[model samples]
Target: MPRPIVLGVVGDSGAGKTTLTRGLIRVLGDEHVARLNADDYHRYDRRMRREMGITPLHPECNHLDILTQHLLHLRRGEPVLKPVYDHRDGTLRAPAYLRPARFLCVEGLLSFHTETLRSAHDVRVFLAPPEDLRRGWKVTRDCTRRQYTTDEVLRELDRREADAIAYIAPQRAYADLIVTFTASRTDDPSHLDADVLLRDSLEHPDLTPLLEVDHGGVALVRRGRDLLLRIPGDLTAAQVTGLEESVWDRMSFASHLRARRLGEFTVGTSLRRSNSLAIVQLIVLYHLVTARATVALGGDPVRSEWSAGVAPEPT
Candidate 1:
């Protein structure tokens, strides 16, 4: 069997990393993908972090060396004794035995912090949601699920801002795709606009023709060697179908993997769908399946032009 294709999703807390990966996982089938949360490799628990006055966003706070080793192992189709971090109480639980599957999705704060770690992934995605939106998300999630008060989450965000700027934000330069979800004109949570920066590190499906449709919902712009794709929140179902069909037509080899829904997410307890989210998810799916095909043919899954440079600021 070809070794598993590794995807690295790096972002700050509450940047929609999990929400973005969840749809891909559903389409890929839970059993076919091995999941790794980099937070599990943290060097300290919550109490220890507070005592030391360090945030998890700081490189010194994570066991990144161990994470790189485990990522290498997984890429070679090997199993690992992965550490577990329980976010509910901010404690490290017993380690879990993880076996590599067809694909490995590693999501975390600093997955791309080092050269070796960045090299382990066939596809690298960075989530760069606007600060206000991310803070709102962090507050809601931490308060409701992680036992953190709103005030506590807000204070923690302020404390981590410096580290986020120094460590987390710089990793965007190493990503093949930079995804930013911003609030729509109406500021509706369910219908947020998506802006995707597609770097030349990977060969993305041609979306130039979609720009000619004049639906006023999707636009693609070129910036030097990269492309910026903008997807609006309120697209009609027919428009979405047409857009999805264009992408699906390019990846007929992976048609069997399209049974599950894309862009299905919950706001609090209510499930909602976003057309822009579906488009973003499908574009990502295209790359994953394309990489799988390339790997099966014994070819490298990523382009060789990838180099470290300043990543464009998110729009």
Candidate 2:
């Protein structure tokens, strides 16, 4: 049997973790991917957190040990009764059964809080969007989906900022890839540009060929200790298709990656596609496919710690 490949995605509230995870699911197919949200391990519900003056972002509010044990179970291809946290009313639902699949995507604010859990992942990603954009995303999401007013969302953001800095932001240092999405034009969140920091520690497939062939919108540069790929939102659909095709060409054995329309997010009742997002998804998918290949060839893909970072910055 092929071992499962786990990808740990950590980020603060309103970061693009869910968006990225959703795209990977679309590409890999739901049946072949198992999804787990670390937020479900919260020890207290919404009212309890408020009464105790504790935000859900803190470690005390969560069951970190149980979460680590569950991660280990999943890594060993076992089923776990994962807790479910209902975001609609900030309550806990009944536990749900989760079976391991070819790929496991564990995403939440504290997915990498412990060494044991971090060691189980084949890839660790951190989403670090600009504060203003993240705030906008939070406000919009809370208002539309969670029944919160704009003011209430802003207040909650202020309350969580401290926990975010102390507990959440520190996880970036352990991520193999740091993904940041910023506005392409001033005051325009619709067209966002992506800056992906590929750390030196991991053995990543070279994307230089795509950058060279499509130099108009995609550019690669070195930043401190990581390689940064800037993906502009202005790229036309044809340009995006070409880059996606180039990536697919290199991984022809990854038949599941033939799907192009993946990870579409809703914006005020409409779905949208991002050129930058597409590239990021393709690169991540490449890693997962190659890791699986390594296992098929009787090699250990999880031999090294692809989690630690070395002063990665956006160029």
Candidate 3:
């Protein structure tokens, strides 16, 4: 059985993390998955906020310790006393019971705020939409849902940018997957934008299907003295179609973004050092690195390796 897995989707406000999480929930199904929006972890009550003078976005403002504790409990297969934040009233409504399921998805700002919080995630995905798209989404969301004028929203966004960098940005270095949706170039991005998702694909080190060179087959070629590829072999139409289909499957499996159009970008540990972008990238790297670490430690390589080493040792 798979250990309890927790996936975190972190990004700037209106970066489409919620939409992505919802889509995954539909795909993965509710019976096997649980959702926890990190917004529920905010510290200030509306009255407390009026006194303390801060919103949920501020690091000095939220209950990081309690949120960390709950996540730890959830990972341990225990029910968590989750908080409730009323967006309508801007206050903590009441504590709620959040039971662990097969998969737990925690989505929101500051999900990767601290090492403790970071340790709880098995898969950390960062969603960094382009600045223009993020701003537009925030503007629209604030106006429609948060009851803010355009100017006020923009001002708040500008103010939040600094705090976001300091508190939220550093988390990206640990991300296992970093998703950035680029605006479509063919369309007029200024007026209409299409999302071209990018992923940093980890080459599985096995390219057998990708390089199908055999006797009387396509010739072989080398790239940069590294990227090796086999030339096409003499294949009949049916054989050619089969090879093409197999290659497509290989590409899809290795490709990120669930769509192959984006291709593989790059990933490095250096991503954890920067600010907002770093946090986004680091979160993805963190999961990937953590998964690799588990495999290295002779544990099952999955998102939730933290749940390993809990069972009794056989005498």
Candidate 4:
């Protein structure tokens, strides 16, 4: 078996990392993908963090060296006894034994903080929703799911802001792709626009032909050495189908994997779909399966013009 393809999805808390990862896992099949949340590596529990005046966003709050070792092991097709962090009550739980599958999806706050940690993955994606939007998301998720009161979540956000700037924001410079989802004109959560910055670090599917079509509001623009692809949320059914088919046509080799809908998300127990989200997920899916194919052929999965010497501008 080819070694498992590792994918790192790094973002600040409530930046839609889980939503994006969940969609990919659904398409990739849960059984074939080993999931790891980097939050499990927290060095201190919630109460300890409060007492120490430290936040999880800071590197010192995480067992990063151990996390790096486990990531390296997974890349080499090894099993790990991964730690579990219970978010509901903000406590550390017993470690869980995890075996590597065909792909490893690691999502968390600081997965890409160090070079060794970054190099363990075939794909690195960063979520960078607008500050206001992310705050709203955090409030909603923490209040409803994590048992955090609105006031507590807001206070925590304020406390973490400094560390977010110093530590979390800088990781965007290292990602192959930066994804931002913003509210549309009507402020509908389900119909948010997606702006994807495709960095030169990875070879992405060519979307130039789709740009020529007058399909709703989809666009691909070149920005310096990178490409920015925008997908509007309110696309017509026909337009959405055309764009999806164009990408699906290119990755026909992996056609058998498209058994479920791509952009299904929930807003307070109400399930919704977004054309923009679907398109973003499809593009990511393209890279993942493409990388898997390259690895199976005994070739390096990444083909890049990116250099460590060139520091990317913060997105």
Regarding TM-score, does 1 or 3 come out ahead? 1
Ranking by lDDT: 4, 1, 2, 3
Candidate ranking (TM-score, best to worst):
4, 1, 2, 3
Where is model 3 poorest over a 10-residue stretch in terms of lDDT?
266-275
Q: TM-scores across all candidates?
A: 0.97, 0.93, 0.63, 0.97
What lDDT does candidate 1 reach at residue 68?
A: 93
For candidate 2, the per-residue lDDT at 275 reads: 74
* Per-residue lDDT of candidate 1, residues 1-315 (tens digit): 899988888899999999999999999999999999999999999999999999999999999999999999999999999999999999999999999999999999999888888888888999999999999999999999999999999999999999999999989988888999999888777688999999887889999889777766688899888899988888778888888999999999999977889999988899988888888889988988899989899997756544543444443
How far does residue 196 in candidate 2 sit from its true spot (Å)? 0.2
Error of 1 at 148 (Å): 0.3
lDDT of 2 by residue, 106-148 (tens): 9888987777777888988999999998998899888998878
Cα lDDT tens digits for candidate 3, 186-303: 3322222222122222222233443454322423233322222232212344544443344335334323323311111211212111112222232233343344345446684442
User: Where is the poorest 10-residue window by lDDT in model 2?
Assistant: 303-312
True-structure lDDT of candidate 4: 0.90
TM-score computed on alpha carbons, candidate 4: 0.97
Per-residue error at 241 for model 4, in Å?
Answer: 1.1
